[model samples]
Target chain A: MTTQEPTNAENWAKPVDSLHIAHDLPDHAINLNVEGKRVASMTSGFGKMWQKTYRVRLDGARVAPQQVVKVWKEHFPEFWQKGQHFFGPMASISPGDVALINVKTGGVKLSTGILVLYADDVSFSFMTPEGHMFTGMITFSARELEDGVTQAEIVALVRAQDPIYELGMMTMGSGAEDRQWLHVLRSLAAHFGVEGKPTLEKICVDRKRQWKRFGNVRRSAAIRTVFYSVTRPLRRKEKTRASA
Target chain B: MDFSADVRQIDGLAVIDLHGEIMAGADDALTSGFVRATTGNTGPVLLNFADVSYINSTGIALIVGLLAEARASDRRILVSGLTDHYKDIFEITRISDFVTMCDDEESAAAAAKA
Candidate 1:
């Protein structure tokens, strides 16, 4: 059997760019101001017991931080579980700037995490948990592939310590959170100025397929657990009756 | 901040019309409403969305979560009367793919009945 050469479409499927922003962010995180409007106040750290860079994106914009915080409090419970917004009476954001916010957390410490931000038309912020803290930074350089769609190319680098290795971590979970960020990127792009239907369609199709695969895996796992649960007792009963 | 849900049985179908935005602090209400809508229903449930204008990621996640819960119970949940803006957001997130959408309350109710 002859194998067909992979097409440009297959090649374009890869991310355009990705960077470990957790490392390059300044220890004293920089303040993000949008045209004199303070959007978010972030703090960064390095070389701790966790060794991972950490940053906190406090919501501030034209809207009152209190109002945004209220909205966040009203809608997102998982964030509340992370910690109380003690930095100030700040709001996360409401109905603007962000199209979506996706978060992923796992591992023994549950300290490692990734937060992806999809702003307008291919803008993104990847926040990775380092050591015991999280770092926040923007990865601004992304280019469109021949498939005529754009993907994020993260350029930020870090040098303090390899948080993953420093933490003595062995495995990294799947980057499903990263893929969701890509979808948010595409949606933001379309929301702003990108007018390519095919590109948007391709992104949607890819996401649907990915979600379907995830669903299948979950369903199979559930089925297996249920099957074992149902049969375990039967085997015990059979052995008891046979011995009698 | 509080979610209020009213479920009326019309033509043997459960029509769940929700008022107020579904966000973080009010998850309990939303989850309870969904549970009530799907529980003990012999037929489909049509969710009326004309009044819901704003939903955060958590709110959207609740909808998905409810859908998954309903699916396990073999109950069908359909959304109707979504504004264009909300529809656009839902489309991108692909929530529409999992649940059916209708243009108006009547059609959604009818679909549920059928």
Candidate 2:
């Protein structure tokens, strides 16, 4: 094949030097941890890297890849189960947009955020920030197979960001993450009036952990989110006085 | 689209000749080529991107996976022939931090030797 560059190749999200949370939106339980942190790549993580894929074959729905992607991007938050919140400024995913996420787990609320890393017609991806549970990227895509079946898939290439996160993953963190996506796919399939049975495939891409990244614990979101939750009443009192 | 990688040795450096669009289904082939590139060598591996016409974010992540492998084995990776646009993507992802960038194969190979 010749080496001609793609003409008007689809628009990808622009590169960002770091993460900055948009503060114009209404304050929520998960908004505190994301305001000033920089996005973290897989190399910034402290644990072994793993790639987990969750896919649902949308057979009998006759949905094209573009259609699936269109709906997925526009209504991403609606598909999540109750109590898992995702708020993005744009109606669709774009490069450099930041999405705030607050997930409830183990009777505690965990606040974190994602930076929109890339977006195109058929796919989009998010990169995690420092202090998030996973430091890596999650790509959601829809494509038609050779057999003419359209499949929607989410691939998470992640590693724990610190020792605390690694321990959480070993205990219940990974399971919670898995169930959330499962709920999302099922909900999406249901919206299209198709029964979606998603299958999971996990691969341990790298076995060695970066012990040097143990310092990541200093920026742990879980710990900081807890602090914010504890100090919420004081903030509310201050706001009341300013209003008076 | 299909992606293929051909690994060739030049003065103890491995140069992977990459071709085609990089996206969802190209993971296995790239890994196979990377394994071949590192065999019987402890020196640097330089990727020849002269023929690579496109790369998505997933493709970038795939390259990061390879870089992680290279780092684990204590070998540096280099890239040559990336158009300015994709080179910008590398800068955005901060992948340029771990891998050395060059304009062409000759310069990359020279850097590998030095």
**Best model number under DockQ:** 2
- Candidate 1 lDDT over B1-114, as tens digits, reads 467778787777788887777644456776777667667766788888776645544455456556645654557778886766566545544456567788877787667666
Task: State the TM-score of the second chain for every model.
Answer: 0.89, 0.96
**Candidate 1 residue lDDT tens string, A76-97:** 3233223211121124321222
Question: Which residue runs does candidate 1 get wrong by more than 4 Å?
Answer: A1-244
Q: Positional deviation of A88 in candidate 1, in angstroms?
A: 25
Tens-place lDDT per residue, model 2, A1-244, is 1234454234555566667866356554457567777777567789888888999989789889999999999999899989888888757777778888888765557888888888888888888888988888899999999999998999898899999888888788888888988888888888788899998899887788889899999998888888988998999999999999
Runs with alpha carbons beyond 4 Å of true place in candidate 2: A1-10, A106-108, A237-244
- Model 2: residue A140 alpha-carbon error in angstroms: 0.4
Give the C-alpha lDDT of model 2: 0.83
- Model 1 vs truth, CA RMSD: 21.6
- Report the TM-score for the A-chain of model 2: 0.90
